[model samples]
Target: MAPAAITLAAEAPKLSSANTGFMLICSALVLLMTPGLAFFYGGMVRVKSTLNMLMMSFVSIGIVTILWVLYGFSLAFGSSNGFIGFNSDWLGMSNVGLTELWDGYTIPIFVFMVFQMMFAVITPALISGAIADRVKFSAWALFVALWLTIVYVPVAHWVWGADGWAFKLGVIDFAGGTAVHINAGAGALGVILVIGKRVGFKKDPMRPHSLPLVMLGAGLLWFGWFGFNAGSWLGNDDGVGALMFVNTQVATAAAMLAWLAYEKIRHGAFTTLGAASGAVAGLVAITPSGGAVSPLGAIAVGAIAGVACAAAVGLKFKFGYDDSLDVVGVHMVGGIIGSLLIGFFATGKGQSTATGVFYGDHSFTQLWKQFAGVGAVLGYSLVASAVLAFLLDKTLGMRVTEDEEVSGIDQAEHAETAYDFSGAGGGVVSSVSAALAGTSKKVDA
Candidate 1:
């Protein structure tokens, strides 16, 4: 007769009604980040194509949302082959029950479905920033539609889904360090290579039109990220889940501070973009380790992300590649930093148990796994994305005509303006003058 079996499981740990509500709330909060991202990217481009950027994200909601309901979830989460979900028969989930694991209080599968669909939607929209100011809206829509079918759904299934090949291979991505960040970062690079540099790129100084808009976008992204990290806990445990929530907030704050501090020390004035970008860098870094590591661990991850991402964004200068929106800099660099540094810090220590350099897993092995995951995702993503881009470029064409890019897509494609302040003033827009504006700007369209 023993007093107890004495184990982490032996303790009758409990989840709360309040916690359940909080998680559902968090899911909704994260879903909002897609629109927030739209604003973030939309505001960075020149006023000429502002609405186009906004629509990239919004259209994702329409395209991916419908696709997810049809079969995206089955391809992603249904029990099946590791590479691609073999249970295409589960397409509509004709007889599926709610999502539940050995752990209890699992949210309704439909709730989980919508939350993840938002993630799928946003990942492609993130790339639009790299190729903005060009890409015909119809072509962009078709690309996202097709890219989702090819690149995104398969990668997501391989990374996070239960039957995912990467997960089966024992790769750990707590919250899309590889799936969302690496896939998108590398995919952006492949497209940029084919799409070519921004017209004025290094040859002309193309300043961000609105730093305030950038900062606004960043603030919303940070606020929404708590849901992104904490909602992954699905079980709603206090000790582990609570730790993740606090870590997400603290790491973001620290990274933001570190970034502004770096900017102030180096550039004499802390720009809004620096602060906003810092927060995103921190959020991306902490994403992978949030559920499994501690607050202190989060700090190290955030600090490394801040410094590394800041420097990575400057790589375009040295490497001579145009990652137009710093997707490579922030997501790729930060994702790697977080994935690897966790190897050194994720110890199963008191209060923050997980095992890392402090423990005896030896940083080398853990670090290698991180790099292996990165390389695997990168290599696969580059080839696959290049193929997709080539097909699109050759068939329907992934790029806009030089003339269309110069004239801007909003007027030429949509025949609409983002803000009709002029309309509010009872003034009609000058179609001929707008037409002249498009054709006269170093373009012959």
Candidate 2:
């Protein structure tokens, strides 16, 4: 008798309708963050530069989206030996059908592509805050294009790609402590080093022109961050995603309170700016550790980052670096705090089974790994950004003219202003006319 042939059965991957819907919603939420960031930074700049600020963030959405679909996604998420993903299978998303699902993921590959695209869009936009009010819009647009290709794509590959060196080394970055926050913050510092300070740096009082806009931006950011943090799980798992959601809220609230307390004690007042800044610091701090920590751990991380970021923001005055909007302080510093603190606070109960040192694990292994990830991204982003800025300054000029900057970047770059107080008289006359028209017979007096 002939020997019986042996066969094995394997389940093929298919699209998951529920996870697909969740991811698509998450992608939309993440995309909203860019415009929310526009308002956040726009309100912080003087009114003259408001449109420029909003444009810088808005342009990233356009430039990076094109690049991501063309080759950026291939470089970031495609198959490779390691270090970088440069494969043909996913290039231009070629040969990928709408029904195709990502490996080990329940959602369609298209949904995952869009979700990650939002991340790439916002990371460079974060740098706009550091060089606010002085950069040329054209140069910025060019920089975003080049930087995403040269710096962001490679760093993202190293951190999150399946064969990524950092991933293989067991470094934990739930979302983007190293890849997004630290990368953008360090890049901001690097560019500022080359661009020099705004024309009246220390002498001028460049207070935010619109706190209401800032608060609105902050609210939008807070609402969208739920998708940002929880959705990193890539699935609607009740355990990890729910934990991340709760931790995100708790951490943000804790950071806000901690920042207000710090400001009240240090400066004798709880300013609105402090509350907004503190909330952002918390949001940044929890981005990397949210999936690995408990609600209590999130609070601890948030409070620590809030206080640390508050102190770090003042360093620009001492160090003579003109980080216009404190990106380095709140993003880079806060990212480091959150990343390193996860080494101690991780409970080994969410997402991964690896416990932190403070969770009775009794080792500094994860801490060192976190440092390695942070150091690699920071060093690379800083040096690469400085080179990009220097080349742009040499070739295209990175700064607006002194006169243009003094008057307004909105007019210089876009030929428009954010507001027209000249219309105030017309508005007042119309308001009075409406009032008079609405009045009854009492007008006899």
Candidate 3:
């Protein structure tokens, strides 16, 4: 017994380090997704606020990072009941010791915490785009923190944490089909509804200010996704992790083509918007199913998601909601597509793993579970988000004053501009101002 105890003690440190390494990589990968989001969103907005849109992504780093270490992680992954986590304090990574729970690998629990933290940071950032160019920066910072605690942490816990009710029920959300995408999308819709539309809705051309920035952001996102999907396995080597890595690529590429095709058919041109939008839609769709589906299944999933998202985007126009940036169209719809498909497609036994209802699990049990999970997330997110917005609007103020909207949020609220044609001076100044002013005026009219 004494000899065995000594051997176990000798091996603990090596085991812990392995876990630490894996988590570090995962955290880094998730970090990259934020900048990718910047391009994905930046390219969708008019040039006037391109920097503002991109800044939303970058700002989350400063805001969510601080919140995560302070108490955000505890409220999320730390020990708690079904509602939220708080057993730990400010994550004060005490003991400088390896958490025994992760002894199965080299990464530390703190490392895992950081990896997941990046997800929490970016998910909220994704929603800011929907309400971009209109909301106050101070209000947005407060809103994100509140949303993370009230909406994100609880949903994340219920779906991903050990005692999470959804996890207990055996619901398989490989990445964040419901938790991140759908949840954030729903929340975006809620806040935008309260904040109202950008001064102009349908009249302004509002073309993307920078397609190159958009492309760069998307390319980086695609590259970093490998780590995002694979690293979720919590270990460096796992078959499921390998499977997820490949599927992410297949789905993202497939979705990109599908979006382009849809654009060509509907708009008479394959705009860069289609490329960026479709790729992200695919990524969102495959997120929950990455670890569960085969490469072929991933392609089908991505293709279908691409087409589905293309259609979903039009829902806003019909309903008159704006969804300015299509947060609802892409993330919400894509998350649903991925979540439901996984249930019907999930395989387990030697029976071709995740065989959809059509394939075998014909009972529809998986499909129902997926719907339930998604519905629960959507309902909760929308309601919680609405309440938060209402509260913030009442207490701190949600929208900028009407005068600021007319002047432009970048200059009025943020005191910053996305660009400067100063060297060219008044050469284009009169014409540009008239154009922008005309666009805003026509939008109001």
Question: For every model in order, what is the number of clashing pairs?
Answer: 6, 0, 14
User: TM-scores, in order shown?
Assistant: 0.86, 0.93, 0.88
RMSD per model, one decimal? 7.0, 6.0, 7.1
Per-residue accuracy of model 3 over 185-224 as CA lDDT, tens digit each: 9999998888777777777676777788878887887777
Can you tell me which runs of candidate 2 are displaced by over 4 Å? Answer: 1-11, 424-445
Cα-based lDDT at residue 164, candidate 3: 74
Per TM-score, the best of the predicted structures is 2
- Better candidate by TM-score, 1 or 2: 2
Best by lDDT: 2
Give candidate 3's whole-model lDDT: 0.79
lDDT of 2 by residue, 195-309 (tens): 9999899999999999999989988889888888888888885568888889889999999999999989999999999999999999999998988899999999999999999
Kindly indicate the candidate among 2 and 3 with the higher TM-score: 2
Clashing pairs in 1: 346-355, 347-354, 347-355, 348-353, 348-354, 348-355
Q: lDDT of all the models against the reference?
A: 0.73, 0.88, 0.79
lDDT at 127 for candidate 1? 79
